[model samples]
Target: MEILHHDVRAHNVMLGINCIVQLTNFETARPQSGGKSWPLKDKDEILRWTAPEKDSSETRYTSECDVFSFGVLLWEIVSQTRPFDKIKNGREVFKKKILIGERPNINMHMKDGHQISVASDNYFKIMTEAWSQEANHRPSMSSICERLRNIFHTNINEDEIEYTENPSKENDITALDPLTQTTTSENILTSNENNVKSKEEILLEKARQYHDAKDYSNAWSIYNNLLESDKGNAEVKFMVGSYLVHGPPYCQNNDIDKAENYLREAADDGYAKAQYLYYQLLFNKAGKYLKLAANQNYTEALYDHGYHLYKGTFERRDPAKGAESLIAAHYQLHNNALGKLNELEKRYAKEKKLKKE
Candidate 1:
């Protein structure tokens, strides 16, 4: 009888008497075929173990999904720790990593001072195969059972195996598949003594990755969550404010009022870039904010403030000071500063030409 254990996790497995292992949690289980599909209303319950496809509204629980969850369970057995233990939001994991085809690290558990044995290697290989992003690419339960039986029958002694060290930067762990690389999310999560990154920083990195990949909705979600967690965080405020101003597709509708409020908060909190952007939002009426940002050596702010001063766009045009600021911006490789300086010269020449006319 083909069965699909819809929910597969370490908690659902039981160790019976005489070392007999039995799987529990039949509440969500159904036959592999000929069952009424259930709607995905409460995905949060199994988001950590479910496959990437399970996040979709139209997807139905399948044997392949169970295989993916089993892969996570296998990792738990080998590592003796929960996957993504520090992360509370499973949806964030799905959006930031899994949906992009990244998986949990297979080698992170190596630091536990365990000897590398053939059985452990085979276990990791099977686990990775089961976690393949494409459901069809994952091995069936029968194939998984065969592999498990082979490992059990091999009778590899752990004591005879030589101890192996955890992977260092020079010797990074590569996945079994040639197409897959070392676990990116694991690398992000791994904290070192020298440069320990906070969870907030990791999320920000994920947000930037999403933005780079053009997954704007996820990026916006992460930023908004960060802001909610820390309302006074100037960096998140600037990011959220900028996103609200531009309003990328699937992010949200543009709300200038909200954008201005966020920008103003960040600006008042002494964020130089936010000060400059806030000035722009105010129709450049707040020259003080622009000047403050330029004083901080903000490249765009220097170029814009200098150009406006040179063009007499302010109450008192100081061509010398403007030229000074433009030169500083040019030294910093501000692309527009050189062009603006050239325009300044052309404008002066035009004035001389008009004198003759």
Candidate 2:
């Protein structure tokens, strides 16, 4: 019944036809319950997966502690790297960081036009909640297992696998030059013989080429022309919205109103990025937009919400609140912003000390 022990890392995991399990070194396995104190003489060994409060005489080990360890294990699997590897003698350092409310990050990549994380954000979020500082806040192992099962059930689609096996030819054909006519092969060969360019094709090609060259102005211009000609092209509208909102140089002007307008258009077309950006602008002004973005459970907007709470730039400043936001952002790849926030924390602490003087 023992699924894993303390010494186990992700490499020990074995996936069978129906069951996934792990084998661990029992020498490192401390009793999960009814332990008077950690029997290990060296604090370092116990420190590896122990929570910050584990050393306190008042604290006792429990299954909930195992849940914390499970969170670390999950982090290892997703990152394909050791937890807390960034800190030297990282085991203890990681323990301290987690005690102070640090959370492991989820690695992500753009795949098939969708952002995919090494582990789903929902899974990490559940694990994080289950490993909260207060013992009562932690979920029972059975509950954790149920939540994880639901996450996999809802997020993992067999249809995705099937679709990946046979990708749509439409996207592939977009790369083809319209001037070249071919029925079977998608290749578009260079031919001096062709002179005419279809308006739609010309706009698409111009946008693609400009994007490839990182020339947003020309691309924006071409897209604007296309939009004027065919105002109903949802895809073109989405492109213009995205370019106007996020495009470099010109778009960097931070024209929130224009950004909001274009982003709204794209969001209406169901573009997740546009929805996320629009939510940020709205949330930045007032809390009204939080419901819209939060409802979708958009990871980016969640990170922003947490970050705004942490920065307290436009709101109230609370380190604990900011730390919580940073922790949530960590799961969503927004943790990079925490470095500046941490510096601000140190400055605030120093100022408080000076005031006491």
Candidate 3:
């Protein structure tokens, strides 16, 4: 009765009404004693969620691999972020880092023990144990369930937990978008007790739809209107400014000066993304802003600032400070950051070897 969910990431996990947790998307699920799973070609999309051992061309993924993925999912739940989120080309970097025994920083952004619904120590143990590189060293699903039962002080049977199917037209349930943290029908940024969405919410959703549909002109118009109504909204300013910088045709796009002006305004208002974007455009002049954004734990800024500190790109070389910055970015699941750290570790190892030689 063992199941091997080839993809066990957070996006496939769903939380329904009354806090009913269900693991949907059985498209990739196979019997642990399976004959065949997904073809290797189809696995590119799930590279980040697969186990380290999946580097081989073999199609037979074991339950132990699922345990590895579950450990990653645990990291996702604790960090509330995707694995290797900011890495544009993660396959090569991910493979290299995994070969060097790198895993996500489990302690980063950990919530309070009570908030996570399990004692922090127990949760950590479970997550780390599940991630053991030796597949057999990983704990069994039953052991994990036992730990959960102990945490909750209840003898919860497998039958007691509900499993909802993936929503279909008949189900009338909208799946949550991992990026927006909202359902397709509504934005969670606003809540109305009467169940009626506010005008601003409606407009925000419309703007999002337009942007997603690549109707940049309409999206710009709506965001501009929203900005007019709420002049002090830093997020709105960032959206408007970003469109101007990188928007597609017919939306006043690629206006660097205008974009910089808007981004600078948003950056001054303490929006971390804006601060980082502003630094990008004014790299030679806005080193301070890069540091400011890095201080706020902005992932890109951390990677860039760490790179600068390490290579002295626009700052003095201080390998220690650079490593520290890269480590912070790595904790947040930045693959590029991990890549840099791996590079440093290898170099340090080589140096030590040379000294011994």
Candidate 4:
């Protein structure tokens, strides 16, 4: 039955009498078919907490994958912070970084300036093993249980901590196969004292993780906290405004008017993304904001602004300025701008040769 509980996260767990934990949620489960690969449906939000192998299309997943996820669980127990909390695109970046052997922040295990350590280095070591890249290298579920028992049962400041048998019940964590150096979104929510990281830095990181998870409501909550602390932050303001513009999944409602209010504020602060977004919201009527963004070397803005410069549609016709901006955009990975630059350069060369001839 434990094997059947495939999606083991905070949400799926249930508590019975005497605070016993029970794993629920078999949505991703399949019959014991030799731990082979299955067609992953749509990408799940759980990817924030999922194993790298499970995130892969190449490898077949085994229970070892669950061990990897358990590592994230341990992280949650320690940090109470979301995995990749500073990254807005969690899974995409997680895949790129984790697949390349990068793991989540491990600062929670030790404290230089933040609150005292919740879990010791020994526990951190065990977690790193769980999230090891090689699935076979991870400890079996039994070993994980045994080790946790040793830590809990031993006199390691039990006064500061409380342990529960079943993780499914209430706030108590059930230790099945905890291993990993980093925590993920679906793990237990842990909170620790201040560390070397500033409040805004910490909050921003968590907000990124929540945003990446598509848990927009929670992300917004974090955003609001930051906004209250620093009302003049352009990037944060832009994100909130952008959320309003995009609507649904990011925001509950698409309030363009409110979106403009925030976005304009960010744009006024000279934030390149905000300036471009404002230009877009105004039906491309405002070339100045677009120009402002392009001047800041914003890739999309450079391309569009260059296009307008060359075509004289919205801005004045200035081939020299257009070509210069297009050239810069070309190097910034704007394909259309590169193409336009190439065409213009070729035309210039041909015309020069013709004049000489």
Q: What digit string (tens of lDDT, one per residue) describes model 2 on residues 205-271?
A: 7577876888665566566667776666666666676666554763434455665776788788887
The alpha-carbon lDDT assigned to residue 201 of candidate 2 equals 55
Name the candidate that leads on TM-score. Answer: 1
In model 3, the clashing pairs are none
- What would the C-alpha RMSD of candidate 1 be, to one decimal place? 21.3
The better candidate by lDDT, 3 or 4, is: 3
Best by lDDT: 1
lDDT of 1 at 307: 89
**Candidate 3 lDDT tens digits, 254-356:** 7778788889999999999999998887985577788899999999899889888877777777778989999999998898898887787687678779999
Prediction RMSDs, each to the true structure: 21.3, 24.8, 26.5, 23.2
The reply for model 1, stretches above 4 Å from the true place, is 37-42, 112-115, 156-357
Q: For each candidate, give its TM-score against the true structure.
A: 0.42, 0.37, 0.39, 0.39
Query: Total clashes, candidate 2?
Result: 1
lDDT of each: 0.78, 0.60, 0.73, 0.71
Encode model 4's per-residue lDDT on 134-238: one tens digit a residue: 888899876886566444423234233333332353443433325522352234444322213455665667678878988786677667567777688898899
- Candidate 4 differs from the real structure by a C-alpha RMSD in angstroms, to one decimal, of 23.2
